[model samples]
Target chain A: MHYTRDNMAGLLRSHDINPTHQRIEIAHALFSRQEHLSADQVMAIVNTRHSETSKATVYNTLKLFLEKGLVREVIVDPSKVFFDPNTSPHHHLYEVDSGKLSDIDAEHVVISGLPPLPAGMVTEGIDLIVRVRRTS
Target chain B: MHYTRDNMAGLLRSHDINPTHQRIEIAHALFSRQEHLSADQVMAIVNTRHSETSKATVYNTLKLFLEKGLVREVIVDPSKVFFDPNTSPHHHLYEVDSGKLSDIDAEHVVISGLPPLPAGMVTEGIDLIVRVRRTS
Candidate 1:
């Protein structure tokens, strides 16, 4: 599937976002790469060609995308957070030392036997993260 | 099962962490309550009576505790990170609306059908978080 800037704008509109120039660029960066990225990384990519986007704009735009349900946030650890483009049901595999992350299809994973939720509570989403290390 | 400051010292020693006064207080704040706490919450608790602990100290101490396996870090989402005192095998249930978090014993849950890891990679840890919301 081709992810053009035009397509990014369309995606943003469908998700009820304003599709500003910077927003479209940020969305294109994420959707086109289809990889997990931190806010710092997102800013770097958007400003690689021209130093136009500020750090605050990158952060604000990412937060906006999150609020609009256009991306998923993956917290690899306390200090690391990545924005994921694919919002479909899935899990994550993180390379500990390398800081690499990839998606794990939810269909192949089976998680069961969890205790029932507390009274009046309903499930919103389940996040499964498997951290791995390179064998010596 | 008693988690007193004295025991906190011993626990720190066993884990090879230096039991400084602030470190012990931080440990007590986490272990005594056996609850998930953020650095900000930790600092607040450690200084609830006496304003002694600095934000940097609390953050560094928590990092030390994590490196020494004295605690587990729970990332409920992008903006929320909690330090869990219970390090035994377990999962987590997070309240999306109220931001309450609880532990799920790993013994009762069964996870299967994950795809094989890429060659040369070994599993370090698996985190399963079930996000629940209060029924409206």
Candidate 2:
């Protein structure tokens, strides 16, 4: 989504998130890129432009974004978690060697035969990641 | 696999992992339990029996185990990573509220329609985790 500062603020407002300067800057850092980024990566990018955003703010804002349904967390690696700006339902392709991520459009992939959920459990989400490595 | 101490040592030797006292203890801690455990959880369990095993040893041994294909890392939660002693290809069901993980037999789940890999990339593995919450 093309987001100017005003539109970014509006997006946050619509989600009932307070559009603070730090939140808007973080939103810009995420939406402006096509890649999924870790919270540390988000902090680095946000600080590159807005020098005042703290690491704590980045972490807090991301938790808020996740709770507000503005972003999704991708956990392909044990060491770091990636934050995805695209809220649309989809899967992922993770490049193992370089730790890069790409989207697998939800429309293209088909998954079936998930066993019946244990009694009294409802699905919150499904994460399907296909890990890949660059051919030498 | 039923692992007496000698069998655990043999298992390590078969995998080319040195059957050090610490590695053996770590192996027993994981293989003896049916549930997936994080490194901290592994350390906690190991230390309960053998107080000398340090955190670094747990981390290093897990990395070694992952490289040797003796364990698989489950990445369902962003907050912590779980290690599965059952190395066979399978998927998982994560109980979000309780953080419990259960295996989904690989043969039972079927997936298709993965997009063609980007040029010069080969598939490594695929991870499918269905996240669920209790219906109260």
Candidate 3:
């Protein structure tokens, strides 16, 4: 589906999110490119479109997106967290030095020995991160 | 091996750490417990032993330990980063609600289909986190 501003309102509504004008713009910033973006990156994109977004707005919007299951938070590096637009099952490949992150197809990877969850608990999700660095 | 303050000096020196009194106290707090500890927890534990340590001292000493390969940083929760005493190869099981973390034996787990390194890049490490929540 095309992730333009027009579709953002409906998408947000479907996700049970209040599609305010600012939220739509922030959602468009993340969904349009379908890339992993940090809060700063999202702000940078949204700011180009309009000047109404404050840092707190962008942060709150992102947190709302996370809570509504609209985006996944990727924390490969502690300092630089990324919000992944694609929520499909997948792993991550992180370039440590460059701080670049990309998806690794889950179908191509095999992770075994996942223990049964403790009684009264359910599995939320699994995150596998492969961190790499350039030969120095 | 017992992790006591007396041994921390030698351990620090072996890892090329300076083994200052504060460093040894901090190291002993982490290694002696052999559990994942947040910076605050480390501070709390060290504060009881002595009153000379500051917040900056605790943070810098932990950074030094991490750089010197004496500890591992676990970022399960964004706000509460943990310092792991055990450096052995292992994964993590994170309790979403209780904020409890435990080691998962990497040997029992089989992770296959690790792609070859990119040209001139090398693999730093892989982290696998199993997140679970209480059935509520």
Candidate 4:
């Protein structure tokens, strides 16, 4: 999904977030590619266009996006966390060797025998990460 | 799986890890309870017996355990990493509110619709973590 500046602005606005220049740049970096990216990767892409955003801003913006439901976080690796632009209900295919991530259609995957929620606890969300490596 | 000191020693030997005092204590802390715990939690428990281990030791030992396949790392939270002693192929139920983690029998959970592996990529491992919160 290609996201123009206006489209990204509207997205942030709809999520009740101020469409600051930095936020817009971060959103563009994520929504434009429609792929999973880490904060460092996002910063790298954002800086590639000569638009400088502080590391603090990148992390804070990502956190804000997550809180506002504008993006999702994928936790497959211990060292780094991935941010997904597609906030819809979906899973991930993580290449362990290369540290690459791809989307998995949630509709296509089936889960069964999920035990009932423990007492007093509700189901918030489920993260299904399929870690894969090179066939060689 | 009850793990006594001897059992832990045997496990380390089987995995080619020298059964040092700290490693054995760490292993016992994990295998004895069979629950997902963070390094801090493990350290807290290990130090309870007055057998103190440095923070670096705890972190390093956990890393070593992960590499040796004696434990699994769960990265649901970016700030703190959880380690699971049950090295068997399985999934997890992560309580988002309390940070509680429980095991989901690998046999009970099933996954489908995995995409074709990228060229030259092999299947490493899959981590399915179901994040939940309290109902109240």
What CAPRI grade goes to candidate 3? Answer: medium
> How would you encode candidate 4's per-residue C-alpha lDDT over B1-136 as one tens digit per residue?
5689989999999999999999999999999988889999999999996758999999999999999998988888888899988888888888887777788888867676666666776667777777888777
Per residue, candidate 1 scores C-alpha lDDT tens digits across A30-129 of: 9899889899899999999889788899989999999989998887765767999999999999898988999999987899999988999889889999
2 or 4: which has the higher DockQ?
A: 2
Residues B53-101 of candidate 1: C-alpha lDDT, one tens digit per residue: 8989988989889999999988776676799999999999999888889
Please list all clashing residue pairs in model 4, or write none if there are none. A122-B135, A133-B121, A133-B122, A134-B121, A134-B122, A135-B121, A135-B122
Error of 4 at B35 (Å): 2.0
Prediction 1 TM-score vs. true: 0.90
Give me the displacement of residue A88 in model 2, in angstroms.
1.1
Computed on alpha carbons, the lDDT of every model, listed in order, comes to 0.91, 0.89, 0.89, 0.87
Measured against the true two-chain complex, the DockQ scores of the candidates, in the order shown, are 0.72, 0.81, 0.76, 0.71
- Which TM-score value belongs to model 4? 0.89
> What residue runs in model 4 are displaced by over 4 Å at the alpha carbon?
A48-52, B49-51
Question: Which candidate's DockQ is highest?
Answer: 2
Question: TM-score of chain B, per candidate?
Answer: 0.97, 0.95, 0.93, 0.92
lDDT of 4 by residue, A13-93 (tens): 999999999999999999888888999999999999676999999999999999999998888877888899888888888
Q: What does DockQ come to for candidate 2?
A: 0.81
